[model samples]
Target: MLLDHGERILTASEAIFRGTGTKLSGKVAGIHWHYGTRSHAPELTAGYYNTRFRDGYLPIASMFARHGVIFNFTCIEMKDWEQPGDAQCSPEKLIKQVILATRKAGVPLAGENALPRFDQDAHNQIIRNANLRLPEDSGNTTVEPMCAFTYLRMSQHLFHPENWRLFVSFVRKLAQGQATSNSWEQEHRDTDKFVHAGGPMVQEAAALLH
Candidate 1:
């Protein structure tokens, strides 16, 4: 039923895009689907996950691909299960499965963080997922990097001195496509000039947080 509803929406969207004859026609990027591990029953096991993929997500991915749509997912920072008992229902496992499905379907895959986290560990996990560094993706030449990534939320907490510092480092590493050994002090120094020069823009961003 969910798949049918989604197909109907996509069909309508396709008609609007192809028939509009406007400059923005056919410019839709794709659709986003949020998959949460907690949404599954606790009793579900690894076999259930496999079946869900084979019967559920894989077909959905293929359908989206047929409509020339990208499949973007969330909670990418949940790299693995924290509890050994919950390993069977790990979000990372599902993420990897979806990645392979999108690849097979010939659709672009993108992701976003599930929660707001400014720590290095979370940043590293997101980077790894974005780059498809998992064992499943290893040695696969056809595996493509994520088309994009989005930070989950914006709040005053994100502008705190420490969080802002970490964010700057995170963005720098992502932009450069590699890690850096730069300390927080160094990042602060580098961003000082930009902050000073773009005071108005910075103020505007702060205003949005309020």
Candidate 2:
């Protein structure tokens, strides 16, 4: 909705939550922001992290919390306070920025990646080792496992450094293997269907909590 409407999903959510009366957000909740390139183009531009955030700001975070919207931005970064331009954002810096922004906006945040997952023991352990009871309002503070920890770790590996070399290597390999394999038409359709079906895996991953 935020993407289609171009702004204000968060504010509206808060109003809805307040009107409906629900507790804000959740302990295991998380958000992801995609940065860098979406495709190969003469000019590389536009992505979740690079996209302007001032448009919606914290209304989404705040509203989601007020109404118990657990996770958010399934594929966008929470962003941080820095330069107005997207060039300044990095994965680590963005993480810090999100932590600050979410806190200020009154919703604690985390870097969440979907499963077939990664080990989040570091993130969870920090909270657990502290042995915190749930926040009076929050119910649970544990960063419960959404799936195997490897997915999260792998996601970090894929995006944290913005693995340009890996991407380059892939392109080089594809270019070298430029011969298109002739496949039956039905085979192509079947492959497309299987690829599109990964969406269900993602939803199932989100539903998983340990």
Candidate 1 lDDT over residue span 83-168, tens digit each: 25523436676677777777777878778887788787888887777777556555777667877778877787877766766776
Q: lDDT (CA) for every model shown?
A: 0.64, 0.35
lDDT of model 2, residue 180:
28
lDDT by residue (tens digit), candidate 2, 49-74: 22333422255455545545543322
RMSD of each: 5.7, 17.0
Question: Candidate 1: what lDDT?
Answer: 0.64
Q: What is the C-alpha local distance difference test score of candidate 2?
A: 0.35
TM-scores for all candidates: the values are 0.73, 0.30
Clash total of candidate 1: 0
Clashing pairs in 1: none
